[model samples]
Target: MKILKRPAGLILLLLAALSFQSQDGVAGSNLLFYGLAALALIIFFYIVVSVADNFMVIESKQIGVKDTGSMGLFPSFREIFRPKKPEYLEKAHVYTLTKGYDIPMAGEPREEIREPKVTRFALTPPDFFGLMPIPKMLVEEGDTVKAGDPIFFDKKLNRIKFATPVSGEVIAINRGLKRSIAEVVILADNEQQSRDYTLPAATASREELVEFLLESGAWPAIRQRPYNVVADPDVVPRDIFISTFDTSPLGPDLKLTVRGRMDVFQAGIDVVRRLTNGLVYLGLDGRGEDPSPFEAINGAEKRYFRGAHPAGNVGVQIHHIHPCGAGENTVWTLGVEEVLLIGELFKNGRYDTTRLVALTGSSFSDPCYVKTYAGANIAELLSGAGEDIAENARVISGDVLSGTQKSTDGFVGFFDNQITAIPEGNEAEMFGWLLPLKPRASISPTIPVLSDDIEITTNTHGEKRAFVVNNDYEQVMPMDIYLTQLMKSILVNDLESMEGLGIYELVPEDVALAEFACVSKQPLQQILRQGHDTMIEQG
Candidate 1:
């Protein structure tokens, strides 16, 4: 009885034994070996059921269930191994996540900085969430404005002003369908001039600081979870988080971005510390070389994580550090460069919108970093690579897994730190899907990947199909969110299930890896957005 403690698992093992004993009326030592292998092969969910019976524990919910703790709705890995105490929750905790996938592609940017060929920059309104498609315009075309000049304001949230990144002329107010302002294009001046703003002291009131950030055009850098949208000026966040690295496929190197400008980055952190009453946490790259200067920064606590692609995602960090309050509480996050923007405003007394962007992917001849303003022209950024690229290359603002697609005429996104260009896979490959021997980065076992770096193309081997119910999505996703269930709930507009399944903890980029690993070819990001839009609309 002690040997077979798990009654349910014993029952299943017995059934497996019986099944193997019959062996379709054919018996051999191989059948006994098969039964033994089967028992060891499958002990995940049922491992506890029989064990719990021996211990007189109920696996299912019943009246007056033992209050050992909050019992899981069902058996889980935690049931096999007792859950650890909250010892590391207070202090800095280091996590080595075993789950998660890394997509390696060619064209990592060189460390050296290069002058960009961008003469025109733009501010796309659609890049921001929680705003009307078209903001009330404050400047007309041909109006000369300085770097901090307000170009537009959302009528609903009238206090926040959107500023131009560079001092220039308003060349065009580009519009999309329904005349929604798409891009507020600016013709950069040869000699840039900036308008200085009144900086708040480090000890300023939260309201005063929030107002200052809003008016200074830096509030957009702060985003709230429970829905990855603009941080509401009215709500005070529980805490703030910043990931000081990038681990996406050929992501821009943040160490290069912050090496020489630690002071500016620190200054940004100092000022932002006043916005939240709780601690400001910095998520650092554990895989990078030791003794990084980011660890020495003041005014924030440091947490180290070393893993694949999403180890650098703030959402993942937030989950481990302090599981997002979902809809119950607000958690804010920002990029390192955005912090630099905040720091530059307060420490330098100017709206310095300049940031180092990594231009990557195999389409370019020479990939390197370019110092440019937010929303620089994509064509101009790519023109200085000392060669021309094919017209059909797909340009993406951000990383390959979860980036916005763009044309050469398109501009970089407001929140993007890298621009990726990959060959479009439009033509069919000869039995490529059937054999799949082409050189490319993949996580599937059938693909037979030998190395991480490879030339990635857009040829999706198959089209979207029925939802293949399995752990395919979970294999790549590090977070504990039930991606398959959540995505299915989103598709069906199951608001209650979506909320229960942790929809508040995700944005498109957070789910991009699962999207890539999806066997169903389901657009997870779009579906997540659909769920978010529904929730937002309902609210």
Candidate 2:
């Protein structure tokens, strides 16, 4: 007893006594097993507490617009894990317009005179891959040019041409100060000249077809994710996603874009399907009873995401479904307007980037669709029409929520399909937050407001603020990954954490809506873009 009084010795003696008692079947191994079980129970309880504290809930809610019968903030975990068979039909009735509020532009008034000569140009150069200045000497400084004449060329002397959207004599060979390249100015010749071609149809292998498009000037319409740059035809993607609607403020309705173009749309899908071994997911934002235009495409899968802002974004939709993995490369996504160009490729075996874009806003004098093409200068497109709208409006190439502001010298963005003119409402409202809510205010509320019957304008009420709620990114975001953790890890440049978080599964465009409404106003798209580039560069 005196020797066993040492703590370690006493513990061993106790264990030995227990072992002997168990061998003798007095107290069987049950006592030993019970002790181990008790110890494990303590450890398990500690782990459970730790995990519960660490699990985060990031959510966002709708404040006041129109709230239909959505069940709750986000779908349940059980619903997400065991998805019901989606009876999703590509809505035959495509949305033609979005009714939301937008602040109007404010600027110095300009004259309503039209530029006399408007020279139209092809959007892409022949060797688009190589970097070189747009050619200068194709047309002499004072050469009189007609529609469909060579205006500029690349180093290979392949003519990058322009048609006088209006025929006129060359007024001046203006050069851009920053890039130092030729800018042809022509006075209007006459308003009578017009040329038109019948759209093409689908009929070749994906590579051969892409080459034809590149040569013909149509590749710019197909946008690739990770960088949101024009797709590189050389890199075959996992799949191609075509969005038929846009939820952003002032975005054009896809139903209008696809009018009388169903044949081409179907043909375009067929052509793109040849490029990827994966299924082509066509996204439409509609409910249980709309006539879907995409119903007839064989081998095509259709899905829908019904929500606000990024609900229509391809990257977000992909996030909700099949997220990109660490080593996975690229996926191609495009809007219905751009996909229409695809139909043109198969129909014509050439690139026809020319399409229609809408011009609208309270400041706009006349709101309507304008005939144009990708990469067409705004100066050429908005020449006479500028006077039709208010004097001090800000012109955005895309939409109020996510569009880029372009200068008069700015060419149309390759991905834009709508031009929005909103009055610049930079002036501070007196007691904006203190005032009782009105139907006029655009709020992202979870429940329908009392004045829900009012038609919402371009402006969705709600001052940009910090992200406080758990948005449940996986719910509205169709992809299968944790968005918040992924975003946090990417911003800190924690490469290891990012890898484990599935950084490769996204691009900036996917989080564009979140970036817009965020109070922090973090450059979320920039972060995601950098994360993608970092992975690409490392490879």
Candidate 3:
């Protein structure tokens, strides 16, 4: 029977009718050889329960300490995992937090703010346009620049460049509306100089550490995953990752932004392990019980990843460890505060750009941590730090689910660390979606919300209907793709089913929790940034 036209030849024709009905004695009076040995033991226990439900490994009994120094009520992770010692297992893996994410973790950052007073910084130019396109400028408007100079470069990957965070003068380039380059302003002088170039990160060479991180603009702090962009100095990636924890909501704590800078965070993990020869990994935040000065920093491979709000999204730990298919290879990542600002520019040869940020929300009256620099001046770091802003609040700049809405006199986004602010729902709630119990803040547990400290508002509260697939983007996307078949292959622009539904694992803040659990409020991070600008304008 032509070997039953193959399915491994019909599983060897049902194991030769169960081995000739067990040696022709009519094994239990053969009912077609007992239905071919119960359909080969139900396809071998359905391929061992679908490979143990896709390689399940969630153990965790203890380990989840996220109170990076202060800020009142912000516990959960079931108050740091529980069940203590028995020779420690502590595995991790949870991911849920998509319930109307109003998680402003009560304004953290209790201590460290060191010496933040900048004056005016700005920069922006679409935060270094990720990887190329929109670059050009090179100083225009009274020009003076100093703290690392080169105010723009990539006219098409012109060795990248883009510098300037402090050494003042070039007053305002601004631009916008199709002219593009918005915000280049500088102005900060009080003795800031800084142009040096040194190097010798323990004997450079990886082409002199990628030409000293593309001539000191710290090579756009290394992004590259199929299209997170900026890290293609001839692509030799395959694994770098980094993360170092930020669990989203009001994220940003890399151990209180690298406090006391563990020897510049282990000299930025030995200068990003000399730009990859593979394996750097480093995730962290598997809750906590000491051990993490970024797990005593030495040459990464740490991992951990506890739970909630994109478990510190390093592209969901590179989709649970190395899963970026579609023309593969590129991996890279970086952000443990931009690897301590590229190990403080190869251990202080200059270009520091400071950092710390945080600010936070629920319309801050005093949300903390500011030290500033990368485009500092969100109304001068919330002037006197105890904000009141309101006029329908909303500041943003980064985090309140993938930030950006700026304008409290904007500027603080070159890869923002956190600013937020909140409140701008635009009123009008009479019946508020046929109330079933609503105070707002919903990932729809059939609408019951009264308060998870309700304050978030850019209110969609339902409208842009249509695309309903359900299970709310796989209950807050713990990534393995298939978030509504990759948003229906990015709403049918289907570049080969959006790279076979992975879209190089994804970004737009990993689909901002599937666009905050979309019930078709589909903007879905502007359709994954228009499928990463249509795969970078069709290659």
Candidate 4:
């Protein structure tokens, strides 16, 4: 009876007893029957324990810990009997983008912008010119325009229009060579009146929906993969990918951003579902304690990804689930905030560009968030805020890795929700590279031991050199493509080789990690952008 307390011991005892009986010339039929019964009892006990474990009083937060503890044996059995969580079958092939000095801001408490008092907005043209050429200016200097009025229109794609965020008079139209518009500064009027449009969500055809999005400036939210350009109205995408969580250093918290706006987020999901005949895959943070707010969203397949940076990238998510092939109509990808913007447009019949923007960096006195429009002036937004940014500090419109560098007076990017301020590393160090005790961050372990609190700067620690093939770039690059080979193809203008190496599957941001990890300090993103532009031009 005591032996029965231990299942393994009881099984062994029964086997020994059965063998003894057989040797003593006991009935063979009775011996066989008892052996079968013992085996059945062992299996029955296992099933009961596994079922009971599911009902155990374990908190969701403690699940990972308890499952790895001494009591973890029961959970293992449960895993065997339970269905696996839905995820990409392909192993996530990527390296950590965070360098030794990239301190994580995830633990910092999120502060919301209480009352945003922005008086000026700038419509930057360069933000929209990724792969496509600059759009033709539609508004002149000192011209009055409504909130949803078009400021510029893409000449090649006439349907794509760039709208202003506020109703105001265009104070200045800054232009560069060839009369290309640089930034159109607008002075916001106290009386904000928006140009209203009719909501067609309930009864509009797919064609109607597409046309409305293109004209209303909501179509830019959806970006096609091959060249990472604006989604074409004529091509129906194979699928749509929405990333809810961003794992970039000092990235905006999506959960906090969409706290009370779940309804809008869900509405956005519905509209996106209608656009694509194929499946709409929504990616969320897999390591969270509670279920993601996006889990309640319907009409889309929810896939979870748990890892470091680029895990939150929609391109990474697409690669794991379904990759883009050459000559294929690319899949469209959108961020959670963009989806909410699209949803708000359909619901309100006017463009609502209000977003939660985070001001972060080691240079900030109190890093916090702000409630501002897409094209709000960065300087005006941080005017009264108690920041410790230096005069020469760099103000980036997005995360440090993939964001664009801008001046303090520059405008926030249309697609950016985070602004980082860091000191410019312009002072040269004597034998800095030779110092083995400096606390600066470097991806290479051969360098000096870096302090975790080290303030990262624009310094390329090392100078640009000849292209060297090393494991550094490949280690951080998670995509299945050959990164070094692809870079070489792009460098040599080998379009066919680049296509064969899965160039269509990449964007500038996708190769940003490789750029950071490269010892050569080469601008990988710029090279990829050139290749992307060339491919589009050749076509």
Best by TM-score: 1
Error of 2 at 142 (Å): 8.1
Instruction: Give the C-alpha lDDT of model 3.
Output: 0.71
Please give the TM-score that candidate 3 achieves against the real structure.
Answer: 0.32
Q: All candidates: CA RMSD in angstroms?
A: 7.3, 13.0, 21.8, 10.3
Note the residue pairs that clash in candidate 1.
Answer: 6-50, 6-51, 7-50
Worst 10 residues of 1 by lDDT: 60-69
TM-score of each: 0.84, 0.62, 0.32, 0.79
By TM-score: ranked, best first: 1, 4, 2, 3
Question: How do the residues 212-281 of candidate 2 rate in per-residue lDDT, one tens digit apiece?
Answer: 5555444555666655555666677887787777766555666666768888787787777787878788
- lDDT score at residue 86, model 3, on the 0-100 scale: 23
Candidate 3 per-residue lDDT, tens place, 103-173, comes to: 53345545546455658887776765453335787888778888877788777788878788788788888
> Per-residue CA lDDT of candidate 4, range 1-539, in tens?
23344456566666767755675554877776777677668767766765555445354224433122224333334345644433432232222222122333322325656446788888777776552335788988889988878988778887888888889999998877787778888898777777788777587888999998888878877888787777888888889898888877778888888888899888888899989888999887775545667778999988776556777888887877678755454789888778988888876676777778888887666778888777888877887455557666788999888999987788898889888987787978788777644466555667644344566777777889998887876566666678888988999999899899988989888887778878888898998998988887898
Which wins on lDDT, candidate 2 or candidate 3? 3
Q: Name model 2 segments beyond 4 Å from true.
A: 1-206, 325-329, 376-387, 433-491, 530-539
Q: Kindly list the per-residue Cα lDDT of model 1 for residues 254-310, writing each as its tens digit.
A: 888877788999889888888888889999876744544687899998887767878
Q: What TM-score does structure 2 among the candidates reach? A: 0.62
Report RMSD for candidate 3. 21.8
